[model samples]
Target chain A: MSIHRKNVLGAVFLAILGLLPLFLNSYWVDVLNSIGIYAILGLSLNLIVGHSGLFNLGHAAFYAVGAYTAAILNTHFHIPVLWLLPLCALTAGLFALVIARPIIHLRGDYLCIVTIGIGEIVRIALINNIFGITGGANGIFGISRPSILGLTLRTPTHFFYLILVFTLLTIFLFHLLEYSRFGRALNFLREDAVAAEGSGINTAHYKLAAFVLGAAWAGMVGNIYAAKMTIISPESFTFWESVLMFAIVILGGSGSIFGVLLGAALIVGLPELFREFASARMLVFGAAMVAMMIFRTQGILPPRPRSYDLFETVEGERKA
Target chain B: MSLLSIQRLTKNFGGLTAVNNVSFDVEQGSVVGLIGPNGAGKTTVFNLITGIYQPDQGAISFEQASLLRLPTHRIVSLGIARTFQTIRLFQNMSVLENVLAGCHCRMKSGILSSMFHFPRQQREERAAIDRALKALDFVGLRDQAENLSKNLSYGNQRLLEIARALGTEPRLLVLDEPAGGMNENETAQLVSLIERIRGMGITVLLIEHDMSLVMRVCEQIVVLEYGSKIAEGSPEEIQRNERVIAAYLGTEDG
Candidate 1:
């Protein structure tokens, strides 16, 4: 597609989305909020899984850490949930750095297995109420709602706008990251680590940075999730949650932002729409997933190879 | 002093000694060849020098600084860039992006700056693109800059690897089997490309099986046999060395 047409299509899509909540009922608005949240989470996981080619089946561990951090702080100390967003991100990022340091050297399926173990371990820890801060299996409760400019956001409509704004901001920032030097480095290392290292890219460092940054973004999303639900538990962050996020990235197009968002809508929103299918819904969903995978092996919106204007580069060189 | 020095280097894989007590020096502004029969440990030595595999014994120093435990990327940043025996370009990336990846260590724009496209980041990116384009032009793949590297012909793929390495702006260029599968025409092109690279004053270290190409370009040659250095000399001297000839074409009795 031409750049102009793509921009126009994107603008039209955003306009439709912006006008959606007005027409929908509370339940559908909440569903949109869910899609937005999952979209951000998929984008985060895409950095590690799609961009860097790291198998990460334990992203929920980081999301859980963020949610718990916010929940604990808000419930025990009465801190505003919004105020804990950065802290949640810090805690999750640190957690990823610590856990990933020793195991980052493991290759392929080994790394994937280790991540799965991590997700399970975090869930079990929360269940056991380690350090007595996690409140055992029942999980923390009564997380206060977020407020903005002296307005306490209470309705699904209120949270929708908040999530919409946050999702837009995430898209903007991640789009920049996707085109940057760092993004190229991730793709390079993903393609061939030995060659990337030989070409002067610090492969290990870039991989770990991707891990930490992805985890931090997931953590921020966790804070929003806690505020939206006003309650949290170990059940909310099972290994299944991680699988959903992973599927969203893979099903949408591993490295493409639009693919992830589409994946999120299909995975999260479709399931909701299928509610009327009753017991047969999951069966249909499974068959649809299988068909999608077979039809689009590279995902629905695989990332396009980056291109630069040769004449522009030549002009730049001449001017220089 | 030599630009890169290796002394008594050895690396063993489990029960087998892949490289044993190998020693060599790459002098400044020289094209050197490490040639041998298959499984002669030539590539192992290259790996050791590039820090892919640490030497079990002895030392490697670049510009008089110890390279003992430095990582591969660190070694490249210290001015040694190499291509693989098998072309390892980022298959899904554009040719320009592959070269841009090679320019990574030379450009420094942190995550925040990159995300924001800050003035410094934009400036560095522009400079990197220019450098990458120049390298692509050098390898005569400038017109295919936006093509996915995997889509290039085999010969062009090999040239793309060279362009990627040159993007590093290295002091020493190490190529593993540059002419492994090239035709006569491609090999001829590579010979001139090496001369042009040498004219740019970058030291060249290569492992090539094509004797004619090696004889035509290499100023110094190191011959290895079964993980041991059998001979080291100029092309003419190596041509006369009995052991080097025997290693390549076996003894009459055998």
Candidate 2:
């Protein structure tokens, strides 16, 4: 009900974007759709890395979990994709909870290493096992598009709308969560876990919440990918893909939602547009990341400014 | 029963026994001071009571319930809260947010409600904010609610830490060095503040170095020397104890 000015501008921008498919070709529209997916993944990653100050190296694990869950259910059980979206998100979230319980308990580099292991283990299992159901390394094909009533979501225009809706929803949800009390707890954890815990927070629960919610976002995007590509493969869920997601979050500014979107567009959109110079792209990105870390450790966007109205209760004068 | 009772509590760090068989009691609606020389293990006792360190051998009971094996947050939720000697605040957060985080244990909405922003969750969140504001108001920093805590002056930061702990609505509040680096006036103000806190009917346990302030405000004093309890008495009794005299002289001689 209390829509901020930023939300109003965002709504207007979305209204303009809704009409873009009328002007663009199917190929361009498909590329745009992919951008939406990447943006969602980037935003989700941002929650843990940027806002929560978690260093995640295996976010693609959740993305893969989402994609594979949708793929498996549709391919085996013939579940309708519309109904499968939430299911896939829940599956990914549950898997995240299970994996995060042990892995998220470890902080900093240890967490990164464990998540990397999870991502690798999941991808390898998908590739090596279940030759009959998953097509193993060859991957699953002929995955049908989602349909609503009698309308098939096979065309790029239709898929664009679907991806846009999910992406917008993800953005909306991320913003809402960031502004909530839970989000404040995450920010406290990010600043200093020990201090946050000392403040009487159940630090473990909040960290788990960040991991689960982030996975859910990635999973939703994964469902969209499964429908758009009509195929799901282990090759698509490589560990490097996880690293790339990390890159987007860092490049954009860890806690900034808009930063993630910009990061995703830069990382995913630029490479395709500059395919001729593909070999140098990653090298440049790596260099830029290094330089950015050195020059702008806070990233492109600054962390949210601390609001003083929130501090009105501490009656003492400033000390240190 | 006392508001807080520590019996035979012991903490060992490898070969170092940081706290050895320390036992004490905090009466409800009173201020108690834990004081000693720099290496006296006053902080270690606070840590043990707050569940930051597992006591090797002892029972800690609050309001007649055993707290020896409970986790830190659980201890806090049971109406025991504390501030650190080094002032551990959520520096990047607004002062109010730092305090609001202290209210997390009291939040009843499940994680599902939090993520979805359910109506109940919103109500709880608002209530938390209102409660945090009241805690901030108690500390007199209500005007700086939105400022990053790290930017505040040192004195205010100390107050902020206490206000944050107060957000937990503790019946027993432990402050580790509330006046560590403060000036004489600040220490005097702090002495009054501790009295006001005790006035609220909450038990107060503090570790302090300002001898004048501690002597003036504490109803009872417990002294530690090299991880051992040397004396326990009223402030006037502690100041005249031969063992207390020797402990301070030992540091001076060193």
What DockQ values do the models have? 0.81, 0.50
User: Which parts of model 1 are misplaced by more than 4 Å?
Assistant: A312-320
Measured against the true structure, the TM-scores of the candidates, in listed sequence, are 0.97, 0.94
Per-residue alpha-carbon lDDT of candidate 2 for residues A1-320, written as tens digits (9 for 90 to 100): 45598779878888889999999899888888878888888888888888887788888889888888888888888887667888878988999999898877787988888888888888887888554566689888777878977899988999899888888777777777776777778888888888777777778888998889889878888888898888989899898888888988888778888888888888787777877886998787678789988998877876576443243223334223
- What is the alpha-carbon RMSD of candidate 1 to the true structure? 1.6
For residues B40-127, what per-residue lDDT tens digits would candidate 2 score against the true structure?
8999898888888888898989999999888888889999899999888888778888888888778876646666899888767767
As for candidate 2, its interface RMSD to one decimal place is 2.8
> What is the DockQ (computed on Cα atoms) for candidate 1?
0.81
Candidate 1 lDDT tens digits, B1-254: 89999999899999889898989999999999999999999999999999999889989999999999999999989999999998999999898999998899999988888788898898788878888989998989999999899999998999999999999999999999999889999999999999999999999999999999999999999999989999999999999999988998999987
> Would you list the clashing residue pairs of candidate 1?
none
- Please give the lDDT score at residue A248 for candidate 1: 96
How many clashes (backbone N, Cα, C below 3 Å) per candidate?
Answer: 0, 31
Error of 1 at A150 (Å): 1.3
**After aligning candidate 2 to the native by TM-score, how far in Å is the CA of B11 from where it should be?**
1.3
Question: Which one wins on TM-score?
Answer: 1
